[model samples]
Every structure is written in structure tokens, then in C-alpha cells.
Target: MSKRWIGLVVVLWVTACSPIDPKLKQYLVEGERLYVLHCSNCHQRDGQGLRRVYPPLAGSDYLKENLPRVICSMKYGLQGEIIVNGIMYNQAMPGVPSLTELELAEIATYLYNSWGTQTGLIDARRIGPLLDSCARPRPRR
Candidate 1:
């Protein structure tokens, strides 16, 4: 191909791909800040949790399978034993009840997108119902 044609093809390829949404970018920035403040203590800034005590969020099978529970845990806290990857973790992660729905979405977005995961934006709209569902008490059978 001619140089001009090659250059044109490259430019078209670049322009054809959409840029990251501005809202997602903003959420990532804010989410990172929130993660640093609330989660970095145990999960670490790298998303690699402390060995044995905290499960690694970087490549967590638990996280991959438990989106609703993970979202609930952010607001209501998580307790008891859980398996992440293949290891068992039993620490009680304290809830940050003060976090708004949007904040939760931001944090979720950051976590899901970072550390080799790419689940995309966890919108605030999606968070509200999940929180409500978790808030309701389950009836005994």
C-alpha cells in the first residue's frame, strides 16, 4: 500500500474507535480516591489484599461471581468466611454506610475495571435496587 493510504487507514482505525466515556473517566478518578481512603488499608492500593487475612481483589473469583453481594458489602459490610481464588478468608470488612450510591458505583467501576478486570461502569442506578434487596430481611423457610 502507498504511504498516504497506509496513513489514511491508520487514522481511520484510530478515529473509528470510541474514546473512553468522560463520565467513566470521572468515576475512575473519584473511585480511586475513595478506594485509597476506604479500602487500601486491607485490599491495598494494588488490589492485592494482604495474604491470608484479606483476599486479593486483583483476580478474585469471588468478586467475579458476586457482583450483587460485593455491591451490598460496600454499604452494609461483609462478614464470615468467604473463598477468594481458592483460599478461605474470614475477616469482617466494615461497611462505609456514608457512601452514596454514586460513590458505590464509582468504587465498583474502579475495582471492576482495574487489576486485569474489565466489567465496565457500575452505574448508580443499578446500585440502588441492589442495596434495597440486600437491606430486606430474608424470611425463614
Candidate 2:
């Protein structure tokens, strides 16, 4: 094969492998709305949480590494210390137990794609099973 043909093939392959999903825009819009309603109060509109209190989602290291934990925490709440971008946060974050799987997926998709991360759509189909296995918080002593 010629160099030009090889280059064209490579470009075609890359494009085919990364086609933008049609539902992404819809998901992002819904997610942003839901985040404003359900999460912005604490996490803030820009995802910059209050100083030394609520953890910021903007460029959060915790979010990058803890997708499962984040998912579970959304529905079940979170307690104890968690490191976000090397900062130690020990505050208790209450979850939204009422959010459905689709809602959670939308929110996840927004957060993961917004700020600095680009994790794309977090499908509700992928969310349901993970939520089923969420680890419940222990009762306070």
C-alpha cells in the first residue's frame, strides 16, 4: 500500500473508532440541569466547592480515580476522608437517595465530561448494576 493510502486508512480508522454519540448533547444538558438542582448547591456551579468544606469537582483527582465510589456515594452518601488532587477532605457528603439510575447516569456524564475530564457518556445501563452493589455506610457509634 502507498503512504497516502496508509495515512488515509489511519485517519478513517481513528474517526470510526471515536464517533461522537448523538445523545451526548442531550445528556449534557440534562446533566447540567440536574447538577444545578441536585449538586451545584454543594459542589457549586463551576464545580468549585467551598473552601476546605465541600470538595471541588474541577480537576478533581478523586473523580478521576474513583468512579465506582463516586457512583455509590451519589445514591448512598459518603463519609470519611478522601483525597482530591492531593488535598485531604474528611467531611461527610450526604447522597441523593431518590435519584433514579438514569438521573445518576446523566449527572455522572456531565461531571465526568465537564471541568477538565472528558469521560464521555455514562450510560444508565452501565449505572444500574453498579448501584445495585453500592456499599452502605456503617451506623454512627
Model 2: weakest 10-residue lDDT segment is 131-140
Per-residue C-alpha lDDT of model 1 across residues 1-141, encoded as one tens digit per residue: 899999999999997786878899899999999999999999988999998998888999998999889989988788889999889999998889899999999999999999888888889899988887785324349
Candidate 2 lDDT by residue in tens digits, 1-141: 999999999999998889678798789999999999988998899999989888999889888888888899988899898888888888898889899988999999999999878988899899978977777777779
Local distance difference test values of all predictions, in order: 0.90, 0.89
Residue 108 of model 1 has an lDDT of 94
Question: TM-scores across all candidates?
Answer: 0.85, 0.81
Model 2 clash pairs? none
Candidate whose TM-score is highest: 1
Best by lDDT: 1
